[model samples]
Target: MDIIKGVPLTSYILLCSILFAIGALGVLYRRNALVIFMCIELMLNAVNLLMVAFSRYFNDSNAQVFVFFIMAVAAAEVSVGLAILMMVYRNTKTTDIDALSKLKY
Candidate 1:
């Protein structure tokens, strides 16, 4: 909790909120699949940051463990997601969301 002791909870909340909002906005407004994927990772990282912040604030290690698991899942997700995106790009020659309406093989 040493780091938590140095910073206020409110500051952590604000930073995570901003990060999540940016991620959400990018997911909603961005047309590129890769950009949207990165934004989703941003959102996940923001959540992980909040979880660690809360864990430290409350002196509980459970949230930190959960964050670790989440990070592992996110890593797996990125590997699979990037592969799919690459396949889509190869098929369509573009990564635009609108261009991927029908994914029929």
Candidate 2:
């Protein structure tokens, strides 16, 4: 645990894990779809940070490739998710997913 080594890998990973956990909790507890989307983004960023840390420590290109793929998937997911969110907002006049209870069909 060299405190002078300019941020240890384990510390970076632990911080990322904590941030991801906070994002997960926010998604679980928030009613607004937009806020949940933001939390999901936070979690994605955390994963990206972890991947970057691993890549740096191991001098590996595979982790960087994986991070790029994750970014692509996240971009696609946000595009589709925002479309659905717009529909939800149009129908309910609110972005709160919990407020839309008519999806039982």
Which 10-residue window in model 2 sums to the lowest lDDT? 1-10
Give me candidate 1's TM-score against the actual structure.
0.90
Q: Candidate 2 at residue 17, lDDT?
A: 100
Clashing pairs in 1: none
Candidate with the greatest lDDT versus the true structure: 1
- Where model 2 places Cα greater than 4 Å from the true spot, the runs are 1-5, 103-105
lDDT of each: 0.93, 0.91
1-105 in candidate 2: lDDT tens per residue?
Answer: 533467789998999999999999999999899999999999998999999889888889999999999999999999999999998888789997878888777
RMSD from true fold, candidate 1: 2.5
Q: C-alpha displacement of 101 in model 1, angstroms?
A: 2.5
**In model 2, which residue pairs have backbone atoms overlapping below 3 Å?**
none
Q: Using Cα atoms with residue i matched to residue i, what is each candidate's TM-score against the true structure?
A: 0.90, 0.89
Candidate 2 to truth, TM: 0.89
